[model samples]
Target: MNLALVFESGDYVLIGVFLVMVLMSVVTWSVVILRIIKLYQAKQGNTAAKQAVMESASLEEAAKKVQGMTAPIGTLTADAIAAYRNYRNTEAKTLAEALPLNEYLVSQIRSSMSRSMRQFDGGMTSLASIGATAPFIGLFGTVWGIYHALINISQSGQMSIAAVAGPIGEALVATAAGLFVAIPAVLAYNFLNRSNKTIKQDLDAFAHDLHVRLLNQKD
Candidate 1:
């Protein structure tokens, strides 16, 4: 409707707030979409990798089976295979030599697991920050709107219903705008965080299984 008239009277404070909300929404949705795609790819790779490991002759074969997989589990599998090849070539013959080599391989798996988890958590902090701050930002706009309305009334020496209600409505709209930005942000943050956690948990178990598989190798 008369967007120009609405923001014109408020010295463009509401317009500024609206723009900020729009930016936040854009950013939040971008992250949400990207993460969903990445996570889905990772989850699919995970299922394939699990089947590969179960069906293959050895852990090395499993890694080879799932070569060039997607992120998260793909990275972990590649690292495990690399570590397996490196240590196996060392030709550690005795129990003592093998024990140390196995420890080294476990360390490699942990490092790889940590890196994957970090990647899974990417963009989460910014999502949380946007959800937390958007409401207060809107409230700031609302507070300023009310203050501006009071100034307008004092200057004009008129406390008419039309004058008072207009500014208050403008300020209240700020609160509404804030909720608009915050709600979806919070919902997305929760959903993604939960899904990431589930993936992380699966990775943790897979790392353990990989550790056992690598150490059990009759190299």
Candidate 2:
């Protein structure tokens, strides 16, 4: 008659819907928590690394300061320095090395940026997929629940409002559950996306400055 009773009397399909929603919710929160921690650490480390690079007198000094750093800036600076060293040290230059030093450094830094960005991109696709699909899955459950409710009413020959309302209301819970699962996923997706965009801007700026500094140091 009530929500509990509806669930208690529900068949496998209804229970399956509930289970699926629960799983989605668990996955969503797990990703949200892990990503928050990751981005926070990355942002903090990157800030420090950027400061170190900005304050340093030369690329070699910056490399020494940021050595073993896991953040994007560290990766970019390390890769740039390594490439520059290799370009200078190589006795026989390959065809790829035929490119101007600036162009070659730009290419290497871009690759490093991509690698760093990939670390932040983990779980984003899953969040997006859940945000897009959860509502529909819940709606399907609601429809199925209503079908079950109507079947029970027909068998009981119950046409009264109370009898109809209880099961129908119970069925509506599926839709509510769907929204409950989806809203958080969608919100998290947007929030994390914005956070990543900010980090990307920082990476782009750092890359340009790093390139320019490398060029200047070369000269």
Which segments of model 2 are wrong by more than 4 Å?
1-3
lDDT of 1 by residue, 100-188 (tens): 76687778888888887787677888789989999999998888888888988999998999989877886778778788988988999
Task: List clashing residue pairs in candidate 1.
Answer: none
Give the top-scoring candidate (lDDT): 2
User: Which candidate should be chosen as best, given TM-score against the real structure?
Assistant: 2
- Clash count list over all predictions: 0, 0
Tell me the lDDT of model 1 at 58.
Answer: 71
TM per candidate:
0.89, 0.95
Give candidate 1's TM-score: 0.89
Clashing pairs in 2: none
Model 2 scores what on Cα lDDT? 0.88
Off by over 4 Å in 1: 1-5, 91-99
